[model samples]
Target: KLPPDDRLAVLLGVIFCIPGSRRAAMDDSEEDDRGPDESPKRPLKGQACRHTASKSSNDDEREDGANDGQERPSGSEGSPSKKKSRDNIPEPLSSLHGLVPESPPRFVSLEQIMTTANGVTNMMLAHEIAMDDTFKLTKQEHPEKSLEHTVKKILHQAFWQVLEDQLAENPPNYDQAMQLLQEAKETLLGLLLPHNTSLRAEIMEGLDVALVRQQAEHGTLDFGYYARLLISLMARMCAPVRDASVRDLLKIEGVVPLFRGIMDQLEVMKLDMVNFTIQEARPLIQSHSVAYAREKFRAYLETQALLSPGLDPLVHTRAWLRRSHEELRALSAQYSPDPVLNGRGASGPPFAVVLAKAYIQLLCWDPSWEYPETLSMDRERFTLLGAQVEECALVASVLLVTHSVGGASLQDISDFKEDLRSHTRLLLQGCGKCSEEELTEKLKCAASQAIKEVQESLQKHGFAPLQLSQERMLYDQVVSMASAEHHIRKLLTMRILDFIKLTLSSASVGPTKIPAGLSTLEKELTQIAGTFLRLVTHNRAVFGEVYTDIMAQLRAT
Candidate 1:
């Protein structure tokens, strides 16, 4: 080593080791898609996903290539498919074909295949884990003290006893303890920043392994001094969350125990740093995530293209866009004779319209067909989101219908509202795949309960209960709300759709406050909506060209 400033010449002295440094590195690819419902009081988790578009000529915030979090995949590379005219916009020579094969791909190495597979798997898993509403890296103390815990303690005690015996020998063998100390020094340095010059110097000088080795050779090495010094420095540097553990290190008397405490505290601090880094990176990640994910996916797509042409990476993508094109046509026909949709005016919906419709399909996706490769990472998320929407919609509709029928009679029934909401929501637990008939049955049950609760409330309050005819009319109306054709159900669904539609369009960025009338359903629905919009927004930016081509073809026809 060069000098004491060099920091690692303590060859034959004690050092510490911790497993915390082995944690998998986390990238800034998350869009804050926090989703969970263990506690209804807690809002859905994660930040709104954002992606900018070329159509907006966004001169505002640009992360990677996104502007204002609106989505436009082509950016400066290309333009969106315009409303009426197709000028300055190029057209695809042939339709996107995922079912037909053109040519077999050349041989690809196993290494290449494994590399791409790992990257894709890691990206998907990381997002899924971090998306939990209460996800945080934690180290539980004592952890119920199971048999395994006892066994681990015994093994650790035996090892420390052997180490104690070794140190007590005439000339102590510092081999293992030295290794541990070296490991600790490396870990502490890992926690430092370039600007932390004074702390770095303090750590390097205070724990100088060279000087420690010299002292050990002369029978004068003070293990407690090193441990206490490390504890002192850590107390100054650690996050407040770890302050208690650092202080507890001072209570230990034996060298082995003190060193053990030091390593344990170091691990906690290491994990603490990780969690802090993730929290700090959230905003930056949100801003650049759309573009960042696109670049990663682009690289993966190219690799797949070269490896296996027969296995088109975008097969589901083509199918997804095709469905949107069909939807756009149906929508246009449904509102025909309108100048804008007929191409006689400039008010027609752009690719954003088609894109919104496509995302809506995810709410009730056919489970048999694999989700689009572009959205494969979010299949589980979209499934849960579908349930949240249906749940919110059902809850709101039930309450609205209940109040209408129970009017005045159940006016003072404060507890009835909460009761109805809880009962209706309970009927929908794990209802991701409920059939149309099953849903109607659930709604019928909800209707009966509403009436029962209303009668009980009215009788308890000494008010006249509803007449039989009134109950019959109320029951029929509530059950009918189960059908998609019903006005209230359809209206609520449309409002939910509008919320998502506006959220996806560049014209409606920062739509945290939605339109009125969805007050009861806004909390949970908004969370899912923000995540869905962001995922779709980033996805659209990545596949904007494919969508633009499909839109152009549909418009031309």
Candidate 2:
């Protein structure tokens, strides 16, 4: 018999070999079982058992040739080639050279045979139980709570149970059982080595004790379940390591194909979400615009008729803002898909909802708090009020233009604005005196005059002719799409110019202190401005005159 130390070394090598050591034995067993006509079974995924069998045959043929002193093919008659050939032979096979006897041992130990038989029986039982249909059904029903998952969870319990049983047994089947577990541990450690050597070693020790204990208790090794558990643990352990590796690799390289696929998917998801919100919000947006315009005009009419503007203007605006908030919130909730599903958050609400919320907050602010009666028309008061108004208009215009919701073209917006402007002439027509068509013409004339005056003002201020023309064209396009009251539109344009003037003025420089409530809206506006700046820079080639003017204007601010 081989000495205990040499035998242990052989066992260690066997454990280390895993599939390589077991494959030849398994193939031999299958050959013995096969009928004359039976074809070979295909190897499982990532397995090269058949190749190993072919390689073993080649090795045997070489050994036979060497025994007969036949000359073999050689790349070179060199020390390096001889050394490489010797190195290529597996350590386990080489270690057996002096250890294996010329003839098989004559005596068989009854105790050793019984222990091995019992271990084999235990292994068979565990494999059979693990392969039961109920386990498969349970796995299918609750994948996260499957036998495989449960095994991982109860790993410590199973390990201790096996360890205690192994220690308690009169004659434990530690050799066979521990070999099975060592094979699993070695396989897992191979994949997780270098990164988590200490962790893997601890797990291996626990696994070794558990396998021995379980085999001692049940008379069969739980190799199937334990193998699966080790595989799962390897995957779980490797996931973060894989991600860190990917990030490091990415830093050194161009775009990875896998990441490109992920980006493509993300882009598709973003587009789908944006399109969905636009489709849902279009009708609501149109109704909101119409309602706002109607309320503003009605309030204006009341103000004109009353001795004092009274509380009606503020009350009506507050009521409209509240109603708009509710409707927009409902629209957003209906259209905005769950962000977590896409592994993202903090995207905020849809564009329409954001604008509506900003509008409501701006309009619902108590003017008296900042502007008492004495200071109502002061420059500071007008600046703050005008800035808020301009912000609302700007946000609303951005929402409209970005999505082109409701298919509202510039012409359609112009027509809609023209219709709203008729209200001004209607008030002048005195007690419903004018026709809709006649009022429309008068409203059109007034709007044209207002636009012409603004253009002239730009020219007077030394705006380049080409730049001014382009600016006017873009303004017309944007203003035509605006759904606010005509007075609001005019005042908004003026406030923008005022803001530009303030920004350029030597009175104050850098950003001004903003209130907390206005911070969100202000941040959004800054982002929008940055986006516009980029567009102006990149598209200068196509819209050079317009972009040049816009750039000049933005830079001035």
Please report, in order, the local distance difference test score of every candidate based on alpha carbons. Answer: 0.64, 0.38
Best by lDDT: 1
For residues 26-114, write the lDDT of model 2, one tens digit per residue: 33222212223334343321223225677577667655554434333456353687778978966555357577634321332333333
Model 2 clash number: 6
The alpha-carbon lDDT assigned to residue 388 of candidate 2 equals 44
Candidate 1 global Cα RMSD: 15.9
User: Model 2 clash pairs?
Assistant: 122-219, 122-220, 123-220, 123-221, 162-213, 162-214
What is the per-residue lDDT of model 1 for residues 1-557, given as tens digits with 9 covering 90 to 100?
Answer: 22321111110000101122222323222122212321111111110111223313332322323332233344444335443345644555343665544342255544454445544543443343334434445543344578856875776677677778888887788866776676677668777867999999988898888888888888898888888788888898899878887998899888888887887777778777656655654454444445445555776887788756669777777788778767676577687856556663333456777677788888767768668877787787788877777667667777787788778666456687668777877865554357778877887887888889888888888878999998998789878766767788767766776676666664735555564546755666778787887667666766677667666665665
Q: After superposition on all CA atoms, what RMSD does each candidate show versus the true structure?
A: 15.9, 33.9
Q: Which 10 consecutive positions of candidate 1 have the poorest summed lDDT?
A: 9-18
